[model samples]
Target: MRPVPDRRLWLLVLGFSVWGSALGFVYVLHSVGCAFAWPANAIRLGLGLVLFVHLALVGLLWRSYAGTYPGAPAVDPTDSFLNWVILWTLIAAFVTIVFTLGPTLLLTTCT
Candidate 1:
């Protein structure tokens, strides 16, 4: 098993995952009749800012990942962070498409 992460790192990851999931859930609601249009870019910016702050706070915690743990392989922390940023960007794009194009598609079938 991997070593237990420090409390702060655990908390940081939990916070980000929850924040992202909550944002995603709200996007889903907007999809299904929540009335408000999804501001995908703005929400993406907010997520980026939150991630930056969290990373700065937990910067030290990432040092441990430089080397392999007992069972885990070595990982590049920078790449991992970048990967998450890219993943979030893609999700934002998908949400944007849903909000922008989905309605048009819905409108077409009825007319």
Candidate 2:
């Protein structure tokens, strides 16, 4: 019989996927807004909301993966390649967040 996949692995995959999608959605929203010449403030506000939600989701995922807080599950095994993938995924998501939000902070107009 095949052994069941680790719960931690599932968590890692789910977290990465959600975070990645959130990042993509933020950019897509911005592009759509710009395409129709929506107000700059409106686009910024919408993107800001998306960033906030993404950060929240990332926080939850970090807590689940690291398990540093009381009552949290133990950290996943370090030996597994999946664990490394999770770590890289988290890093990539954060980088994406910075790239996605930096323009809003520095620029006031879509052009």
**What is the clash count for each candidate, in the order shown?**
0, 0
Quantify all predictions' global Cα lDDT against the true fold: 0.42, 0.66
Prediction 1 TM-score vs. true: 0.31
Task: Report the C-alpha lDDT of model 1 over 1-111, residue by residue, as the tens digit.
Answer: 344346534433443444355446445543543234435554444445544444443343333433322333464564455435434544444454345433432241211
Over 4 Å off in model 2, which ranges? Answer: 1-10, 68-88, 99-101
Score every model by TM-score.
Answer: 0.31, 0.62
Model 1, 71: alpha-carbon shift in Å?
13
Stretches of candidate 1 above 4 Å error?
A: 1-73, 108-111
Considering summed lDDT, which 10 consecutive residues are worst modelled in model 2? 67-76
Could you report the Cα RMSD, in angstroms, for every candidate shown?
A: 10.6, 4.7
